[model samples]
Target: MKEADRCCGSAGSFSIIHHDLSMKVLERKISNIVTAKAEVVATSCPTCTMQLSYGLKSHGLTGQVMHPVQLLAKSY
Candidate 1:
C-alpha cells in the first residue's frame, strides 16, 4: 500500500476548520495513491472516505474510493 492509501486529511472537524491545510494534505494523499498503483481505496470513516474520493476525482485518478464494507458487499 502506498502512503496515500494509509492517510486522510479530514481529521474530523479539523478538516472543516482548516480547509487550506486539509487540501494540501489531501493532495499528498492523492499522490501516494498514484504511486501505490491502487485500484480501490477503502476507508472506515465517512469523512476521510469523502476526502479520498474527492481528492481522486480532483486529481483525475480513476481509482475507486469506498468504504471497506461497501466494497465487500459489492463483491458478494
Candidate 2:
C-alpha cells in the first residue's frame, strides 16, 4: 500500500492526451484493488470515481464504487 495515494491516471486533460498510458496506469491501480480484496471503492474526485467503477467492471470485480459524500448522504 506504499503507493496507495498514487495517481490513477484520470488527470483531466492528461487522460485525454495519453489515453493508452492512462489506462495502463489505471490497470495497475485496479490490480491493487483486486489484491486487497476490497468490497467497495470510494473517492472524492468524480473522475477517479468513474475510473474505479470502470476498473472494477473491466477486471471482473463485483465491488461497489461510490463517492464518500454519497455514503454520508445515505447515512443521514
Candidate 3:
C-alpha cells in the first residue's frame, strides 16, 4: 500500500464552525494513521490535508504531507 491515505475529518466549513469537534475527529484519525506506521500522508482536499498536517505536527509525528497529485507526480 502507499505510505499514506487521505484523512477524512469532515473538512470544509464544518471544521471552521466546529473547531473542537473537528479536532476530536482529527485526533482519532491521526491515531489510526500513526498506528499504521505510515511515513507520508496525502489528501485531495486542501482543508483536510492542512488539518491532518497540523495534527501530525502537533503530535510530533515524523511524517511528510503532500497532495495526492503531488505524490503521484513524484512517483513518476
Candidate order (lDDT): 1, 2, 3
For candidate 2, the TM-score is 0.84
In candidate 3, what are the lDDT values of residues 1-76, reduced to their tens digit? 2223534566688888988888888878888778888888777778877888888899999887788789999999
**Per-residue lDDT of model 1, residues 14-60, tens digit only:** 88999999998888888778888988988888898788888988888
- What's the CA error at residue 56 for candidate 1, in Å? 0.6
Winner on TM-score (1 vs 2): 1
lDDT of the candidates, in the order given: 0.84, 0.82, 0.78
| RMSD of model 2 against the true structure | 1.8
At residue 59, give the lDDT of candidate 3.
Answer: 95
Candidate 1 local Cα displacement, residue 14, angstroms: 1.2
Deviation of model 3 at 16, angstroms = 2.0
- Give candidate 2's error at residue 75 in angstroms: 5.5
Candidate with maximal lDDT: 1
RMSD (Å) per prediction: 1.7, 1.8, 3.1
What value of lDDT does candidate 3 attain over all alpha carbons? Answer: 0.78
How many clashes in candidate 1? 0
Clashes of each: 0, 0, 0
